[model samples]
Target: MSNTNSLTEHDHPSVLLPLLYESAGHLLSSAGALTGEQLRAASLLPGWTRAHVLVHLARGADSRVRLLTAARGGADLPQYPDESTREEEIRQGALRDADALRMDLETSLSGLLQAIGSHPDEAWDVPVRWLGGGRRPVRGVLWSLLRELEVHHVDLAASYTPADWPAAFTDRELRATVARLREDPAMPPVRISADGGTSDLSTSDRPGPLVRGAAAAILAWLTGRSDGAALTVDPPGALLPRVPAWRR
Candidate 1:
């Protein structure tokens, strides 16, 4: 479950980290409720089991640790040797025993947190570049990690859903997504609004699709959490326009 915090324009990651830990703790407890068979059951991610989801979550932390460390020490290191190797590692870890999986997840999370804590206050704002190539402040890694945990927690398909998302996170993520969509060459020019005319999510001048809904519903649809089932689209129940994989 997510915290009930709201986002402010000046919110800081330092203040958000503990609440993210609480959210992760909640995710772990939910995972704990599953039996071994359930752990191996297929998740909402096509071809991935719940075990795969858990292991991916764990591996994500490890990858982040590598990035955080490089940011702190100003060293050059790859987040993973390669994407193929990363996938293989997840596959191998997913086959672990339930207890081993849990232990691995715990270990990964703690290790990354320690890495984050190792940074000097000034180091946190230093730019870190991913092996695949994009740079952002070290503190940005924390937000990405939190997004990974919270989003994949839903992907496990055990009991969580978008409704469990924190409003602040949803709002922030949704705004960021809209910014991306505006620049996306593939995304059709359209107008998007939520909450009865209070929100404008699109910057396009072209008159195309008009998607209107509650904030969470629009976020869920944009992020591939749903198929736009409950949203009101122009042309009436129109299918959601295709978009690239989310940039999370």
Candidate 2:
């Protein structure tokens, strides 16, 4: 999750590109279990249908491809024209038939894979701007794709759940989310503990409220994907700070 290692083997295009591919495969498999009619039903994300989630996932891959392609060829590009345009694109695309939606997803994933595969090693270090105006090496886009695929796969409201996430992904995301909280002055300084484990996400030396749960459960709470009602908060019944929405 510490994607700042632009020139390191960890964030290398060769490494992240394949991870994104496997994640895409997992997302596509979850999608495969849905019927065309089911696509019209509501997803875990409020006001979003299963089709909406699928559309966004497909377009997201294309967006990453644009960023990586520009990095490889040394051309200037933006992931989307603007937020409204991106939403509108997803809005229109969501109305497509299930077959067409799946096809578009596969097509977009292929395009991104090809873009990553064709890149030279040196090109991976070229700086690219993300939609939020933050910039990182081209390989950062691959890490972005990982969160998208994994999180949205669960948001599809199908078979995948937070518990379904691989232990490595869960552990990494937990650390990253904790780091994000630590940097935010407005975020409460709470202590997060893995049940029976030593890992703690605390900002200050003086520990605050203790939120105890498994790694995946704790992550879900931190990411705003879960309310953490199931987790045990120390002080016997104290309320945890309302976590701000997860950064996109």
List the pairs of residues colliding in candidate 1.
none
Query: Residue-wise lDDT of candidate 2 within 54-116, one digit each (tens)?
Result: 999889889888888788777778877788888999999999999999899989988887887
TM-score against truth, every candidate? 0.88, 0.91
After superposing candidate 1 on the true structure, give the runs of residues whose Cα lies further than 4 Å from its correct spot: 1-11, 196-198, 235-237
What tens digits encode model 1's per-residue C-alpha lDDT throughout 100-189?
A: 998888888888877766667667666666646666666666677777887888888888888788776777777777777777787777
lDDT of each: 0.76, 0.80
